[model samples]
Structure formats: structure tokens, C-alpha cells
Target: MKQIIEKKRTLGLLLVILGASFWGIGGTVAQRLFQQDNIAVEWLVSSRLLLAGILLIALYKITHRQASIFVIWRTKQTAFRQILFSLLGMLAVQYTYMMSIAIGNSAVATLLQYLAPLFIMAYYLLTRHSALTRQDGIAVTLTLVGTFLLLTNGSFSTLSVPFMAVFWGILSGLSLAFYSIYAVPLLQQFHSLLVVGWSMLIGGTVMSFFHQPWLIDLSTWTFSTVLYYLFIIIFGTMLAFWFYIASLRYLSPKEASLLGSLEPLTAVITSVWWLKISFGGYQFMGTLLILLMILYLTVFQKKQRER
Candidate 1:
């Protein structure tokens, strides 16, 4: 029994790490597509969500042959909620994040998205009448200082990151917060795959109407471009999500979240090395502060649970 549990935990750790790494690398891949191929963000977002959604639903069907994929839409209330989640949560998050990457480097975009937790913290404080904990305050201060340094390179006179990129990046963070918070009730009612799958499909379908990705010219795409596109949809979006969710079967949510810090770290490394994005001393310090904020919150959460 002990060995079995240990093996499961190990598997969980591997899955979560793989999942987060895939996501991190995926952002860099998407940036390459935008920079080299001039691929439209709308088309990529629609294509990725549509295909990934179909694949996930299919996987769920294969694994749980007895379960119904349509169960999430059985009631009107649920159907509405699912549609809203698909549009406002999944689609919004994806579109905004991709826009951020298109406008800036993946490293900055991803780090900005990590601000989702802080937004959630603020939301609860405002809406739920929750008291501010010391740890929360510290984490907020660290993130704010980190963000300022990242954007300004520790100088008040100039902005290191583009203003438009920062605009989209902050929006991406807010959208991510919404995505995480709004999905809770639906997640409680259905399997994560089911909820996520439907949301993706719905969001993709809606985006397809607007972008018409099928109409895009494929003749201009090189072989490598085609391969990169496939990698984004299959390995990055689909497998990343699958691995992360599967990890939850063996690890606690807090543990999984703590492991998720790897996503930004991987993004930063790949962006700096592969994309040749600059990472100056101030930016490095900013990154460390942000990461430290994440670590601090994780410890705080663990202590809160213990208490």
C-alpha cells in the first residue's frame, strides 16, 4: 500500500511538472508564430480552443465510456452558466493571453498572468468581507514592487515593457482571475474535463463565427509552421491541461498550484534563451520578487490549512 501511494505521488509530480512546462513552452511557441508567420491571434485562439475541446471531450468519452458529455447542458441554468464560462472565462483568458504574447514577449506576458491569484485575493476581500492577512499584504507588496521594476527596469523615467503590452497583459491577468473564480461552481457539479471541454468548445464555436479560421490561407504556411501549429494545439494546450488535471488525482490542489510556478519560470528561461528577449538585472530581480510572492502565498496557504 505504501509503495502504491508513493508511486502515485511520483506520477502526480511528473504530470504537474510536464503540464506546466508544456504551457510555458507553448507561450514561447505562440510568440514565434506571431513574430515569424504573422499568424492572426484570433485564428490561433479559435483553432486551438476548437480542436482541443473536441479532443478533450473525445478523451473523456474513451476513459469514461458510461458518462454522458452532454450532461453539463441538461438544465437551462447550467447550460447558461457553461456558455458564460466558455465566453467570459475560457475564451477571454485565451484571447487576452495570446494578445499579450503578440504584443510583447511571452516572459512578460506570463508573469503578468500570474497576477491572477492576487486579483482573486482582492476580489474576495472586496466581495466576501474577508479580512486581509499579513501574508496576503506581503505577497501583494512584493508583486506590485516586482511589477513596477519589471515594467520600468527600476527607473522612473522610462518603461521597459511597452505600454500597450502592459495594458493587454493586465487584462490577461484579470481575465485569468475571472476564469479561475467563475468556474468553481460548475467544476463542483461536473468533472473538470467535462466543464473545461464544453467551455472550450463553446468559446471556440463563438470565436469561429467571428474569425472564420477555416477561411485562412494555408498555402503560405511552411512545413515548420504547420508543425508548430500542431504542437500548440496538441502538446501545449491539450496535453498540458490533461496532465495538470490528472495530477490532482494524486496531489492536493495547493501542492499542484505550488508546482505551477514552473510555468512562468519555464517561460522566462525559454523566452530569454530562445527568443533572445532581454533580461536585465532589474528584470531578474523583478522576476525573483514575483516568484518569491508565489512561494510566500503557498506557504501561507499551507499554514492556514494547518491552523
Candidate 2:
């Protein structure tokens, strides 16, 4: 029975990692589309969230065959908290990431974003929780090193880290950490889809106020642009979030954290294939180190459990 449970948990973690990998693909796609089309970043984010929220909500209703839409307005307190999480987690992180990219480069932005796990570890520590074990430390170190190499192009000194970019990236990381931590509690109280849907809706709605998506020139929407938007909404936001939440049901937070490191790796692969970006030998090695760290942590964790 214990073995069976462990197997199930492993499967769940795999699913979550797979979901995050798919989610990682969105950045490359977005960047490619953005370069080709004259689309504002704000508008792109706003549209993606709004469309994704609508689609997920619809999916939830169709699957359950119930009126979940009305649940959104059941209570002001619930509504407000949902919106708050959405803004802080989804909107804030997304916008901050974009801003970081603008201020620095994709590599820097990605490294900073991947630092969420570290921030999470720190959060736990601050709360008087046990510090991450050797495995966790190894995993975090490996990820950080991998991120640095991935971003620095193998020579840290060659790169000039922009202060603003770093700030935004750190902020993005914290936002994501907070989202993960806080979301766990919310998920316990509400269905994952419902919580996700409401959060997306609230986040999307708040972003719309600032982005004024209506101001976007509809004439700019081309066949390719529409396709790009569709991919972001469907694959990036909706499917990714769904899979991530599903994974949480079976995986420990530590396990999930380790798997989440794959995002940067996926991003790198996408960059190479989709974005036509290339890296040098050292850069590749750095990425490898990061992966190794994640593997070390995960395998060590399994070993510990067995003992």
C-alpha cells in the first residue's frame, strides 16, 4: 500500500513537471510573436488572461455540467481575496517578468523568475519552519548556478546585470512564491479549477483597467497574431495552470519545487528551436549543472524516503 501510494505520488509529480514544461513553451512563442507583430506587451498579457479565464471557466462548466459561473459573486470577501491573489500572483508576476525582460534580457528575466523556489524556501525558513535539507539545498544551488550560466552566456563577468531588471526579477520571483504558498490553502478550500478560474478572471480584469485592451488596434490582428494569442491563452495559461494544480494533489511541495526547475530548461530548448537562439559550450554546461542539481535533489529525496 505504501509503495502504491509512493508510485501515485511520483506519477503526480511527473504530470506537474510535464505541465510546467508545456507552460515554459509559452514564453518563446510569445516573444516570437511579439517581434513579428506590433503588439503591446500589456495588451498581450491582458488578452491572454482574459481569453484563458473565459475558456477555463467554460471548460469547468462543461465538465461539471453545473453553473460555476454564479459562484464568482457569492461573497464579496471571497471575491476580493481571489482578485488579490490573481493580481499579486498572475498579473504582478507576469508584468514584472515582462518589465525585467525589457530592462535586461530574456536570460536574466528567466533566472530571476526561477528563483521563486529559493524565495519559497526562504519564506518557510522565516516562518520558523525547518530549513531545506541537503537535498533541497543541492537542488536550489544547482538551479541558481544553471540559471546564472544560462543567462550569463558562460561568462558571468561579461554580463552587466541591470539593477532595475534584477529588482523586477526578484519581485516576480517573490510574487510567484507567494502565489504557490498561498494557493495551496485556497485549493484546500475550493476546487483548483474554480480557484484558478476566479484568479485568472480577477487578474485579467485588473490588468484590463491598466492595459485598456480596447485601445489596441483591432486592425493589427493578423492571422498569425490571432494564432499566437490563441496559443498563449490555451496552452500557456489555461492548460498549464490546470496541470500544475492537478500535480499538487499527489506531490509534496518539495517534489513540486524540484520539478518546477524544468521551466528554465524548457525555455532554453524553446529558445533554441523556436526562437532560433544558440548558446556556447559553457552555457550548455551551465544549464546541465542546473538540471543535475534538480536531479540530485529529487533522487536524494527518494532515497531519504526509502531509508
Candidate 3:
């Protein structure tokens, strides 16, 4: 039984890492589309959310015909909470992260969003009044130093990007933090598919009023651009959510979110490897620091379980 549990958890962690990988790569691709094609951010966000939401919901309808997505919101209390989460957490995260990408580049946007774990840490401390462990303190310090190195590119005299990127990126981080913490109750009680699908649908529907994605013009887009857009919607948005949500079954929301540190590492590698962006020792060290923090958390959790 113990071995079986371990195997299941390993599977869950891999799925969450895969999901984060998609987000990282997808963000890079989306950044390319935005910069090269001048694609409208509002339209892309609205379309991605709606299309991904619909696809997941349709999948649920097919497999579990007995369980409607509406069952997630069967009670008034739940309905209200779900709507609030959809708007405040889901919608905000999607839009702000995309906006950060549009205003900046993927690596910076992604790294900034990793600040979500910090917010998660602060939240657990404040609400739970939990005392910090030695590992937590060291991890927090590493995360901060890693973030600073990334943004400054190891330089004290200059920032690597404009102020707008920093502003929007921090907002993206906050939104991500909120979603990771807030989605716990719903995720624990329902199928990950049901909760995520309905939340996406509701969030997309709300964003539609502000930006009518159907009115988008694709005349300037080529075959490759179209392919990238589809990939973002299907793989990055839809599959990513499904995998990450499913991981909640095996891991605490905070630990799962902490494991998401992999996304920025993925983004940085993609940026340098595929995009031919320049990189060097300092960035590598920063990446190492962040990875060490993740490693610390993983070991800490396992050790606690053993104890």
C-alpha cells in the first residue's frame, strides 16, 4: 500500500510538471505571436479561455455523462464561491499573465509569476498562524535572491526591462497566488475536471463582455500563426489546467504550486534554446538557486511524511 501510494504521487507530480511545462512553452509561443503578428491580447485571452473551457466541458460530458458540470455549483453557496473564484482568481490570472507576456517577454513574465509561491507562503503564515520551519526560511531567501538576479540580469545598476513589465508581472503573480490557494476547497471536493471546466467557462463568459473575441481578424495570420494559436488553446490552456488540477488529488495546494517553479526553468531553457536568446553563468546560478528551493521543498515534504 505504501509503495502504491508513492507510485500514485509520482504520477501526479509528473502530470503537474508536464502541465507547468506546457504553460512555460505556451507562454513563449504566445509571446512570439504577440510580438511578430501584433496579435491583440484581449482577443487571444478571451478566445483561449472560451475554447479551452468548452473543450474540457465537452470532454467531461462525453466520459461522465452522469455528472454534469453544473453539479459543481449545485448549492447557492457553492455557486457564489465558484463565480467569485472564476472571476477573481481564474479570470484575473489568465488576463494578467497574458498581459504581462504582451507587455514583456515570456522569461521575465514567467519568473515574475513564480512570486506566487511567496504569496502562498505569506498566506499560510497569516491565516494559519503556522510557525516557519528552517527550510521555509532558507527557501524564501533563495526565491527572493533568484528573482532579483533574474530581473536585474545580475546587474545592480540597471533593470533588464521596462517598468510596465514589472508592474503587470507582479499583478500576474498575485493573481496566480490567489488561484492556487483559493481553488483548494473546490478541488478537494469535486473532480478536477468538473471544477476547472466550469470555472473556465464562467471566467471566459465574463471576459467576453469586455472583449468580443469572435470579432477578431485573422486575415494577416499565416498557417504557422494559426497553428501556434491552436496549440496554445488546446495544449497550453486546456491540457495544462487538466493536469495541474488533477495533481491536487495527490499533493497539498501549496506544495503543488511550489513544484510549479519548474515552469520558469522551462521558460528560460526554451528562450535560450529555441529563441536563441543570450544566456550565461549568472542566469544559470539564478536558475540553480530556484531549483534548489524547489528541491528543498520536495525533500522537506517527504521527510515530514516519513516522520
For TM-score, the strongest prediction is: 3
Give a tens-digit lDDT track for model 3, residues 246-283. Answer: 88777766667777766666766887898898776777
TM-scores of the models, in the order given: 0.80, 0.90, 0.91
Q: Which residue pairs in candidate 1 collide? A: none
Q: Given candidate 1, what's the lDDT at residue 182?
A: 69
Q: For model 2, how does the per-residue alpha-carbon lDDT over 1-307 read when each residue is reduced to its tens digit?
A: 8799788777776777776787778877777766788667788778777878778777788888855665745888766777777888777877888788777877778878877888888888889676767767777777778777866677756446789988998898888777777667566656777777777777788888888767777786788878877887888778777777667667755556557767777878888886788877777887788678756755766787788
The lDDT leader among the candidates is 3
Off by over 4 Å in 1: 1-20, 103-112, 144-167, 241-262, 298-304
Model 2 lDDT at residue 155: 74
Give the distance in Å from residue 13's predicted Cα in candidate 3 to where it truly belongs: 1.6
Better of 1 and 3 by lDDT: 3
RMSD in angstroms between candidate 2 and the native structure over all alpha carbons: 2.2
RMSD per candidate (Å) reads 4.1, 2.2, 2.2
Query: Model-by-model lDDT, in order?
Result: 0.76, 0.75, 0.79
Q: How do the residues 36-76 of candidate 1 rate in per-residue lDDT, one tens digit apiece?
A: 99899999999999999999999889999999999988999
